[model samples]
Target: MGTPELALQVEPARWLGAPAPGGLALPPARAGRGTLYAPRGVYLDDRVVVVADSGNHRVLLWYGWPKADHQPADVVLGHTEFEAEGPGLLHLPTAVALVEGRLLVADAWHHRILVWDDLPEGSGQPPDRVIGQPDLRSTVPNAGGSPGPAGFYWPYGFTYVHGWFYVADTGNRRVLGWRGVPEGLRPADLVLGQPDAYSGAENRGRGVGADTFRWPHALVGDEMTLYVADAGNHRVLGFTPPPEQDRPADLVLGQEDFDRDFELPHVPQGPQRLRFPYGVALCRDYLAVADTANNRVLLFPGPPRRGVYLPAAHVIGQANFAESGENRWRAVGWDTLCWPYGVWGYQDLLAVADSGNNRVMIWRLRRS
Candidate 1:
């Protein structure tokens, strides 16, 4: 199919990045500059919590799940300044996950992970424990002079599955696993992707094939398997707990091979491919891929195939937004999407991080 022409109209519902006082903003719907690069994941709530990593170098917290509704996360994490810092300070946080009763943050650029134990606190004030970059720093400005597990290099997404914590080390171009640190501090238990780098200047990006990754942005995992949003490579890599104890992705999804294409990377299949897939989530038997480049969400029925890419069992985006890549992905309802960078399913709500468009869209996800 060729690129679809966009028919939907673009409208501004609200403004963000306003000088919110007391972490609150209402009335006069403040306008955001523009969602050009709002890299964020979803919060576990009926409310759509966004890590609008505004240009301010701070995560802009907004809450409003059903769209028509309006409310914002009463809390904010990171420094009030437009610069990244240590401890409570965050820099370009791309992913946020709720682990146990606390919040887990992948403070990208700062090269570290922060655990906020103060549940429901207005903002992530002083995390109970800070991992990566013992000095506590963001991804940018590596001037902190820290080491790898010693510090993170652009950790993008975060997820706590089964009994472990996973981080998408974007700069390093790999995923790091750690035993879920309930107390004290957990160390990196395993490293996925090019675990070995020749030097500090090289990104560890190696795998069986295309699924190895280019710039890993987000990830999702359950009890037994791990799924990766190999953003730069435009594919999803899957793997089981390694028997060799090395995090080698055993399966693949999206395209047929690593060669860049608007399609998902995998081996050439009878028919199937993805384009710039950014976020991923598994709902029941369905594995959802936010094909970011195409501005659509493609759903696979049987999950990842080690070799071939599967045609979408369902799709949302221009297909639902008038068949145009103009506005990215948008699910005004279920089974629809656009330029969506994040997707998550829990309970009956499916939360999507509609990155470029500046809003997280929610939909009812059901099994047939």
Candidate 2:
């Protein structure tokens, strides 16, 4: 049989930020206006939309689902005023999610994660807690490069799964886990890609391997499975029942094997490979990967089994799996994407953080 293809519903039905596509600019961060720049992370549900407005050093929260284009946000974090990008502010906020009524943000460049316990009552409120550093004012990696259990350098993204908090500590080239929300400089409950918690080595100090990682950027999974976007390695690694310690992934995507780090030679470059796959979302039988550098999203009608190089069943943002050019050699539009970094799927809605274009595109999946 031939590869499956998905039919999206009538182009992108809605966008959350920026009226038009534009490059990075430092303007007064405003809601429902053309102010977002290089937005890298986004999460939404039936009631709320949260964006890691990275370029502005802040996070924007829209309490209700946006009914129209460019809807104003209900809350903002990291600045007392929209124009300020000062100390104690979010430095390159790259991830955002709600955990137990609290808002968590991966403040990437600051080398820490910030948490708002009660989801900020209004714009510019301070965070209730901090992780990876002694306090909110400190931006040091592992607190002056000490490299211990709590030190993190460039933590890009995270996910809460099976009652554990997992962080893709990108700079450290590992993923850290905690049984609960971390408070201050505490040791992680589990560590992956390093010999021990104190060691920060690229690919676990052994170079490339199925069990090692280089720039593991994003994570999403559940109790039965785990997926990590190992960006630098140019593959997505999957683990069954979630590994508790350093172990090899059972499934590998975008490469011929887990030991292979380079993209396979496909004359037209197809769905069986990936180029800097940055974001992933899986719900039930559905899976979506933001093949970032290739400028498209790959969709699988069902999750691939362990130890198999199953090709993606469908392609989004491009006409087919064979073409990998930015925006499929077309202008940036609702039907096209450029360097999308984060994606989330729930029910029938799929949201993509189209980073290069600085917008969030929402699509309704159609099975036919």
Question: What is the TM-score of each predicted model, taking all chains together?
Answer: 0.73, 0.91
Give the range of the ten consecutive residues with the poorest summed lDDT in model 1.
20-29
lDDT of each: 0.55, 0.78
Over 92-150, each residue of candidate 1 has an lDDT whose tens digit, in order, gives 66677667766676666566666777454444456667766544433342225433443
| Model 2 spans > 4 angstroms off | 1-11, 21-32, 83-88, 264-267
Q: Which candidate comes out best when scored by TM-score?
A: 2
Clashing pairs in 2: 142-151
Q: Evaluated with lDDT, which candidate comes out highest?
A: 2
lDDT of 2 at 230: 94
Residue 199 local lDDT, model 2: 77
Deviation from native of the Cα of residue 164 in model 2, angstroms: 1.3
